[model samples]
Target: MRKMALVNQKGGCGKTTTAVNLASCLAGKGRKVLLIDLDPQGHAGLGLGVKPDQIEESIYEVLSGKIQIIEAIKTLEKNLDAVFSNVVLSAFEQVMAGVPEREFTLAQGLKEIEDNYDYLIIDCPPSVGLLTFNALIACDEVIIPVDSSSFSLNGLGKLLETIQIIQDKAGHELTFRILATNMDRRTNFSNRVVETLRARFPRNCFETEINTCTRLREAASAGKPIAEYDQHCAAFLDYQQLMKEILREEAKMKAKGFALKSFVEAKEKVKEPMEKEVAFIIEAPEDAGVQIAGDFNNWVPESLDLTHSHGRPVWQKAIRLSPGLYQYKYLVDGRWVSDPSNKKRADNLLGSTNSVINV
Candidate 1:
């Protein structure tokens, strides 16, 4: 079976939405698919119309060894079966703490029914905890659903770093694909974010983009996938294209002997130079919208936005620069201001001072 997990430490990035819809679409294609909800919120099961009260035996029971995997399985559709989750699953980390090889609990449990499905889709929790680790250990591939927001872009680097750590510590080889979700095609900022993502991770990004659609949210609220809610909607078409892209990639990989392995290795080889590039950072309120504007690109702030640093109020932008002096300013919530962190200043034509830096 082809196993994959949808993971992102940041919330509201369409991680659960993608997981539920993708699994439903895959199963609709006549493939036997199993979606395992590793999230404590139980949103995946709930998205499929499985109420919390209806779930007596959840993934918590199976992982705790209180019941077999089959006992927790609930048939959702013709070819789709799901292993539900509940709030009690939140206690898994504390409960399994101090146990040897606890990271492999889910992996060990999957061995019982690994042969019964064509695809195994795991919806991981929003945090990088023991439950997320178990999903990582069990899956060979990861799909990171990123939204067209600056905050979402900010978390991408840290999430990649976490994945690298998991690979090194577990001694496992895994590949990842970036899926752009919640995309608003009408806005230039959204388009720019997608362009930035593609430029940063060209080899790992999927060509299919999930556009912003109200029907998608309505479907989730109605406890149905886009396919069942409205097959003719744009969201359904986007997901169908995404499904086709995945299947096509799988076929191409099988024909070329899984060339993506080398693609991932190539990314690792260029990691050092990428990290050494110049970065522009500024301190701003977490609630304020921040962007960098300078002579680099005709002083258009919309062309370059700053991303929030992980767990901090500071925002940053990393860009390649040659050895030269540059002047810039920060555009915070529509007001242009000099960078407080940079002491060096230069007079601009606008009768104001701009922060100066030498690379």
Candidate 2:
């Protein structure tokens, strides 16, 4: 089975909505899909009209070893089955704190039902915790749903850091793709955010963007996926395109005889890097023309231009710097500005501050 998880540390990023609708769309395509509600909020189940309280068992029971994974499965449609969750799942972290291999609990549970479905979609919580770790460890692919709001972009780095930690510590290399969600095409700011995301992650972003639509909210409120609620709606079409894109990628992987398990095993044998690649990211308008100037480059303002995929607001540049203390600032539109994202700053001779970084 091909396993994928919808994960984002920020709330209201359409993580759960994507999980529900994506799973449904896959099932609608005649694929057997298992939707796992890993979030304690249980929004995934609610969106599909399955009340967590009404279910006899949930993912909590499966992960906690109170019951087998199959026992907690609730059939939602002909080809879609879901493992629900509830507020009680919030205690999972504390409950499994001292347990050995706690992070592998969910992975082990899914072993028995590996062949029962063609796809496994997990909806992770809005926090980086045990449950999120389990989902990440179990899934080979991760879909990071990012909203159009600039605030949503702030947590992307932290989430990427968490993913890197799982890969380095658990020996699991996961492929992730960013899906732009909650986009409002009518507004210039929303369009810019999407454009920036695509540029920043040229190879890691999906072409399909989920536009903001009230019908999507109505569907969730009415306890249904967009596919079932309004087949002709724009949201439904967007998700349909997403499903097709995923299937096409799957086809390409199969054509190449891709084996996720073997790939991960091979990756585990790779050596660690001696130097760290530090990324400098800043938000600015598309026309800002941002660049990084630092002591490493003799404070040359025009030495390194922050490059992005498309020109939106967000701009970033990654450079390998050896262990040392350095100070830098961004040259935006010929004006110098300290990194707003970095709190560590040093006062210069001019009385202004420069961002400090120790690598």
Candidate 3:
């Protein structure tokens, strides 16, 4: 089972919404899903129509050693069960603050019931406190929901640092992906934020952006996943695409692991040209003529001009190049800048980081 946590230190990033709807959608695909509410706020349960006052035992009990996980879980949907939490959990951090092995509390509790579900989706609290630490230790993977607002983008680096801390101190390695939520494509500011996030973490960012939709809020307020509330709603469609992307990525990773030899053989036998098409993107004024400069074109600034993609604010260009590592940057309206989506970069002699791409 893949235990995935939707975590973000910043608030109002759609962590609960993604957890509720994503869990429901996965369950709709016939996979047994357990949505664990690790937050003290308990919105996960409340959003699912699970009354806060009605739930007797929650994840708080499980975390506190007062009860086992199964005792606290309640089946909400056909293929989905929830381990809810509430405000009482706010005291848990202080209670467990003095306990030994505190960071592994959540991990230890879930380990006993590991086989009960095909996937576990955890809704983490907004703060990077003890609860969030436990989630990090317990989860096999993390999906950081970053809002499209410019300010929220600043938290991405900090969360990545937290994951690095887990890797260093806890000795647990985890893969992570970024989901851009609350994206308003109609506004250039939001679109630019999304593009910048994609450019900074190209390998980790999901291609499917959860565009802003009022139906998402309506579903939450009505105590239902978008799928159950209004299947035809725009929110439902966006989440459906997100679910499909998640499944596809997981399948590809699984195939790579279980069928490594065949996969490699098949890839080698494809006999496709070694040259790859690399997409260079950067956010610039609509009328600004962005050009790419790198070793690929002998550092010529005006060799390749970028154009907007389907009325989007960001400029993009796809160039075919042979298999190799290349250092490149964009000249946006005459000013040079590194690709914001690519974190892998090298410091040039000019004291600027050049984005690195390998094909």
Task: Give Cα-based local distance difference scores for all models.
Answer: 0.80, 0.83, 0.80
Q: How many clashes show up in model 2?
A: 2
Model 2 misplaced stretches (Cα beyond 4 Å)? 258-359
Displacement of residue 199 (Cα, Å) in model 3 is 1.2
Question: Quick one: how many clashes does candidate 1 have?
Answer: 0
RMSD of each candidate relative to the true structure: 10.2, 10.6, 11.0
Q: What 10-residue stretch in candidate 2 is worst by lDDT? A: 263-272
lDDT of 3 by residue, 93-153 (tens): 8898778899999988987778778788999999988998899888767898888864453
Q: Candidate 3 regions off by >4 Å? A: 254-359
Q: Tens digits of per-residue lDDT for model 2 on 1-359? A: 88889998888889999999999999999999999999999999899888877967989889899999989998889999999999999999999989989999999999999988889999999998999999999988889999885444447757876887786666766877899888888988787777555534445689999988889999999999999899988999999999999878666555557653343333334323555889888888766778887754435554344455565557887887656677789988889899998999865434577788877
**TM-score for each predicted model, relative to the true structure:** 0.72, 0.74, 0.74
> What is the lDDT ranking, best to worst?
2, 1, 3
Name model 1 segments beyond 4 Å from true: 256-359
Error of 2 at 105 (Å): 0.7
